[model samples]
Target: MKAFYDTGELACVALDAVTGPQVFLSGFPLAGSDPEQGQQFLLDHAAEHGHCVLYTPDDSLSLTDLGVLLRSQQVGAARLTRPLFVKEEWLESQYFRDHLPLEGGSD
Candidate 1:
C-alpha cells in the first residue's frame, strides 16, 4: 500500500493489514471532507438526498480520485473514462446537455 502511494500508481492507498488500524476508504463529500467526514450530518438528516456538498457522492469520489491521481503523478491511465449509472430521463433532458456535455451514460 505504501509502495503504491509512493509510486504514482495510486493517489492514496490505505492499508488494512501489515499495520495498525485498518485504513478505511470511505467517501466524503468534497464539502465535508473534514475530520467529521459528514457522518454526523448524514446521520442527523436521514431523509436528505445528499452526501455531499460535492453533489454526487459516488461520482464525485471516483472522478476526483482519478483526476488527483493523474494530475499529481503527471501520468496517463489505461482507461480515460468510467462507466456511470444515472437516470435515463435525466440523461435525455436538457439539463444533462447543458451541464454535462459528455456522451451517454451506461444502462
Candidate 2:
C-alpha cells in the first residue's frame, strides 16, 4: 500500500502496522473492517486488550516508556530473530550440557 507520509512517525507507523507490508509475516489483521480506523481505535483503547506484543527496535525505545499500561510491561530487548529461537532450543538440549549460560546468567 502507498503510505502518505514518513512511516517512522507515530500515526503513520501505527497505520503501517495495521495495513502495510509486513517484514516477517503476512495477513495480519486489525480489529475493525477499515484498516485506518481499526488502528486508531486500538490505539485509543489500548488498555482493554491483552497479549499486545509491541516490537520496538532501538529507534522506537521511547514508545515503551509511554502509557501507564505499557510502562511496566516492557520485557528485555534483543537482536534476536527466528534462527535465534532455534539456537536457543538447541542450546537447551541434553546434548549441549556444556553450552549453558553461566551461573550468574551471563551467556
Candidate 3:
C-alpha cells in the first residue's frame, strides 16, 4: 500500500505473495542497483518460469490490506531471488571472469 512504497518495504512483502496479474514488482532499477532491479524483472522471469501473480498494491496502499488484495488477485507463485541467482551464476562463470584480470595488473 501507500505506506509500503512510502516506507520502501513493498519488495520485502511482495516476496511471499502469490504471483499473478494483481501483484506486480514496482520499483525501477534504482541507483547503485543492476539493470533489472524492481518487479518488472521479477514478473517477466516469473511468467517465463510458469508463475502467476496473486495480488498487487497501489504504490500508496496500506500493507494491512495486502493479504486480502493478494487473495482476491489469486496470484500464484512469488519470484523472489531467482533472477538474482541466475545473474550471480552468470557473474561467477569463467566466461564472465575471462574479461577481467585475476589481480590488479596491466596485461
Against the reference, the lDDT scores of all candidates come to 0.26, 0.24, 0.26
What digit string (tens of lDDT, one per residue) describes model 2 on residues 1-107? Answer: 22112245321122122232333212323311232333333354444444232322221111122321111111133121100111222223344323322111122
Candidates, ranked, TM-score: 3, 1, 2
TM for candidate 2 is: 0.19
Could you give candidate 1's per-residue lDDT for residues 1-107 as a string of tens digits?
22122233332332111221222223423221231333343333333543222233123222222221100110133212222223333333445323431221211
TM-scores of the models, in the given order? 0.20, 0.19, 0.22
Question: Candidate 2: misplaced stretches above 4 Å?
Answer: 1-32, 47-107
Error of 3 at 106 (Å): 49
RMSD values, in order shown: 14.9, 17.1, 18.3
**Tens-digit lDDT track for model 3 on 1-107?**
11122234332222222221123334432112222344445455456655533322222111121221111111233222211111222233445323321111122
| Candidate 1 accuracy as TM-score | 0.20
Q: In candidate 1, which residue pairs clash?
A: none
Best by TM-score: 3
Report the CA-based lDDT of candidate 3 relative to the real structure. 0.26
| lDDT (Cα, 0-100) at 94 in candidate 2 | 40
